[model samples]
Target: MSLSSKVRTLKELPLYLPRRFSAAQRQRNRRNAARPPAQGIVVGLLAQVCGRLVKAGEEALRIPERLPPSAQRVQEELKSRGYPHRVVETEETTRSAEEAARAVGCGVGQIVKSLVFRGRDSGRPILILASGANRVDVAKIGKLAGEPVEKPDAKFVREHTGFAIGGVPPVGHPERLQTYIDEDLMRYGEVWAAGGTPNHVFRLAPNELADMTGGKVAVTK
Candidate 1:
């Protein structure tokens, strides 16, 4: 191990490279480090969108939680029957079919105009759940009831149905009346019904309403 031998061995060794990236490679690394990964960015955006959607849904649910007592009862009744539709209360009145359509932003045919009629012979109430756009023929409804039908006054309506003329529903009557359904009402996929008050209404599918009311669908012509 002489000094000259050590010097010759060191001179035969390979040259050393610096422990640093080139200028171009260093610039590329800096660019990559400056921004988040594509996958992480996408996942963060998706999380934000999902959070917004959940918040919107919660707000919608809360908006309908302020229904009036009468409307609340209707809401409860519908939920009890497995219909989870919300009761929407409007500032405008929905007493008439036209008014209801305008207030609900739906067609007149989409409103369920509940009517109470007196059976001339049996003296029992005959409920006709007709389409708002329909003019129910008393003769046709009478034929369905098997007795002459007369439009009952508001007093009779309240006494029999436990609701006012503008807020009558197929159910929630003092006594279950024989109800006839207007076939035209079944045409609409969805219909708006009074929720125990004129200003309160609820969206209901025609089939579900028919089932809930236990009424026979027939042509009211």
Candidate 2:
């Protein structure tokens, strides 16, 4: 099975099992659990990547407890990186850049959307970070890639990134996928992105994020 398939199977197994936990089961789970909650490994890994790239320390801000759906994990990862973050609790869901901007009171251009596409070569996934105000120019992307760039469906996105489409982060694929960052994001000194989970988010400079992800800087949209 593909890596995406395996992760899907693992994520789905819980649905077939009971929700209640026995003492032994809980104990076993605790023994294997990692700190700061392992449910958001992708978010955690994003922070690790940021740490490696920034070297001088980066800011990772967490959202409030009652904040949107995908910024929670982002908050944790940001805190881990020593970034000063404010948690703004709101009713808006951060599923899109517009919504995230509204919830955080930022400009639409400042919302960084992590996008995933099926690479033209090897058929593996590639990640793109684009400004909220723009749409991806696929032909341009194809030329840069030297291969055709195709949009993957919802199932394909979840399978490859281990996160739903609306909550895709720049880092933390089951495998390291090729990443491209939009040049437009450079306009803002700081921008926000999903934290791996729907209820979390984090902010960073675009150049800093590019460095952290080792992402190619391009006009993605």
TM-score of each: 0.67, 0.60
Candidate 2 residue-wise lDDT, 155-186, digit = tens:
87878766776666665555677787778667
lDDT of 1 at 84: 65
Quote the positional error of residue 17 for candidate 1 in Å: 72
Q: Which stretches of candidate 2 lie over 4 Å from their true place?
A: 1-91
Name the lDDT of candidate 1.
0.56
lDDT winner: 1
Model 1: lowest-lDDT 10 consecutive positions: 40-49
User: Which stretches of candidate 1 lie above 4 Å from their native place?
Assistant: 1-65
lDDT of 1 by residue, 130-164 (tens): 65555667788878888887766677777877776
